[model samples]
Target: MKKIIFVDSTQIGLFTFQAYILELCNLNVGFGIYIETFDIPLVLFEKDASDVVRLSIDESLVQFIANKSISSRIERQQYFNQLLEFVKSSEELAAKIVFKEKEMEYLADSKYLVQMRNIYINSGNQA
Candidate 1:
């Protein structure tokens, strides 16, 4: 298990013990949940390490999260504002080029049924 940190424009989401890079790829590939290497002063994951995958979130996902987040108007605005600042401060794009290329190569091979299966299995989960 690899410890990894994922920082976006506003907040940082930490994923502990990343087992496989392919699983991260599959996560984005299947769910459009973009997770990639961070371009920052302190490198979160080693360049050659495959256990940890960086998280790269974008604008569309922002809108999606905003809608999904059960926050008040002020809170949402604060979150969105922070995202804007991050976008302005950072110039490097999220680490998605490789996965994006592979997705293009195997466009039709998406396992949509697999996503449904995971969803069904987790739907009954109660916390």
Candidate 2:
């Protein structure tokens, strides 16, 4: 069966908290993360077997779901719909970092965020 791990990005000690999501996300699974009202889909590996992503993250109200297998397109859409409500009521700080809807302008379109994920994972693993 697939697993679901929700990350709490709003908590203190980023590197420490990241370890959970990082470890699970590296297992070639369907890892996903959602913070506050911010919703961004994170995939550990893009493959046909992506399902039940064993996520390592903090627990929060706006829960991010990761499937273990390739879910139907329709099902995925429904999942998104359900998430909207939970995300809408989430905290603002985490929402800014998770969603691409922010108007920060500075790091808005920057690809470094993806890079930062890698860096965070790499560094956390070493510590």
Candidate 3:
């Protein structure tokens, strides 16, 4: 299992961080649920020789703010304040994403079944 170390961030940055985590899951990378708080530079992920992946929450927040063009300092401060309320660690977030992905897959499969049933019914009408 690959160990992923994620820097913590706010709710505003959660979605973007979740995307990266989900991608890592798809790649079959494994990470633990340990949460550690500290000051670190902005980065997404770094892989070392020991197969440890480090993710920086500050980097994710910066990217999200830049992408949204949040120029106002007040809005930025609000995000920072809300960070205290964002509780889930990286592993938990990844789990949620995986669960949601599975749910969507199931829905898609059901849709295929419905389409097949419709096709069968239409063929019977034609016959």
Q: Which candidate has the top score in lDDT?
A: 3
Model 2: runs farther than 4 Å from truth? 1-69, 92-127
lDDT by residue for model 1 (21-117), tens: 2223324321122223422221121122353333333333333343345555455445444433443333122235223322121111234323322
Q: Provide the global lDDT of candidate 1 against the true structure.
A: 0.30
TM-score of each: 0.29, 0.23, 0.30
lDDT tens per residue, model 2, 42-120? 3221223333212222322212222221334444444444433232333232334333343221222335333433333
What is candidate 1's CA lDDT for residue 39? Answer: 20
Tens-digit lDDT track for model 3 on 1-127? Answer: 2334443443353232222332243464432322223222222233334544433334343443345532344544444344323423443454354333321122122343244223323221121
Stretches off by above 4 angstroms in model 3 are 1-47, 56-64, 83-88, 91-127
Among these predictions, the greatest TM-score belongs to: 3
Q: Could you tell me the TM-score of candidate 3?
A: 0.30
Estimate the Cα RMSD of every predicted model relative to the unseen true structure.
12.5, 17.1, 19.1
Decide which is better by lDDT, 1 or 3. 3
